[model samples]
Target: MGENELAEQFGVTRAGIRAALIDLEAQGLVERIRNRGSRVRVVTVEEAVAITECRMVLEGLCAAKAAVAASDEQLAELTALGRAMTKAVADGEPVTYSDLNRELHARIREFSGRRTAVELLERLNAQLVRHRFQLALRPGRPQRSLKEHLAVIETIEARDPQAAETAVRAHLGSVIEALRG
Candidate 1:
């Protein structure tokens, strides 16, 4: 909130701090008022649901495309990641599973070969970190989502684009429901 304080702590100029704030504001990570300075932006529950709704569509497209476009090597990596996620859940490490969940989604996006969708997903995901993390730590949440995610990987490995897209929508639809709670 204090640009001068930030500048002094980082030994940077006020202009530099202001510029950084500008970028964060553009990213929806901060809110700047005309004269009240800047503060961390809080994403409301409704906004989270809206964001997840958007993700359900875009990520479904990515999953479907990845099913068709992913190379053999990419398939192998995704399979391995699924196994790792299973192990993480079985070992009672939701945090680790959550991290692997991110990796799995990222790989799918990359394999889809849709640069624009991947970029937009990245921006949207940046806004969901807190909600996603909290959900990951919720009791039984990881276990439930694990099967959904595995279904996505399984369908993609089966080279079924329609099924892959359905699986992705199902997964994110559950996310939307949870966010609404």
Candidate 2:
């Protein structure tokens, strides 16, 4: 976008937009062409795969930690969230299911009791938003994802760290496969 457009959108001056664009360019999150203006960088297939793989490992660890650390209240909340997601699936509301899906994962990270991991995961998740939305748009994927989430929640509630880890990895592995396709 043009510097003026970004400035107007963010309520900043053109100079401020330029500075921010320069920073984003340096971070490889945008490309600044002399005449063409800045644009969000497109994620490569390889980058998407790498991000999914990293998420699999990190989220698996989070599930294992959550299995050990989650309290009864937290587990109850997860159960409620799972039920809501189920209803969303049955009602054929992909958008609602997607929102609940994000919340469910965030709660799992919160229950993991690892502040640093949660923060890192948030950053990683921000990078995956576009790809995740694409995956969610796939036909019948939401129901399958809901089942995987239920499995992960069940393993966590059962207090089986190893099983929770395995379940999370499997869930994210399916995501990786979807991304590959």
Candidate 3:
């Protein structure tokens, strides 16, 4: 679909869509061709691997801080979101999974009480999502993602700070491995 259609569909102005598309294009998530206009980028395997590496570091910090700062209510909410993420992946809804993944990470950063880290992570997430979406759409990746999400949630719930960080690291590492293979 064209940018105009997309903007109209979302009830946004063409300029808004144009600006967003331009930003995404700069982040390598969209490709603006001479005449063809913009298309969602098809992530290369190497780019996907790189995205995983970046996520490993940011997500690890978020999880570690969550272990220290997450209240019982926040933890419970995280658990619920974890379950929702798992279900979204299991259902093989890549778009839904993408949205849920962003929410899960954002919530973790927010709960961690690290405003600067949260802002940085949010910016990183935009770039990472572009490549991660490619990996998520691969065959059988969704189920594997669900398993990894559950592991991270379990570790965080236990309040084992180091373990939580390790779990997130392992999960993102596995994603890198999967993308490489």
TM-score of each: 0.95, 0.91, 0.72
Q: Model 2 over residues 23-64: C-alpha lDDT tens digits?
A: 877765778777889888888777988988988889999999
- Report, for all candidates in order, the number of backbone clashes: 0, 0, 0
By TM-score, rank the candidates, best first. 1, 2, 3
The regions of model 2 sitting more than 4 angstroms off are 23-28
How much is the lDDT of residue 95 in candidate 3?
A: 78
TM-score of 1: 0.95
Candidate 1 lDDT, 23-100, residue by residue in tens = 999999899988889998889989999999999999999999999999999999999999999999999999999999
Order of the predicted models by lDDT, top scorer first: 1, 2, 3
Q: Which of the two candidates, 1 or 2, achieves a greater lDDT against the reference?
A: 1
Weakest ten-residue segment in model 1 by summed lDDT: 172-181
Best by TM-score: 1
| Candidate closest to the true structure, highest lDDT | 1
Candidate 3 Cα errors over 4 Å, as ranges? 1-44, 89-94
Q: For model 3, how does the per-residue alpha-carbon lDDT over 121-180 read when each residue is reduced to its tens digit?
A: 666666565567777778887788777877877888888879889988998888888777
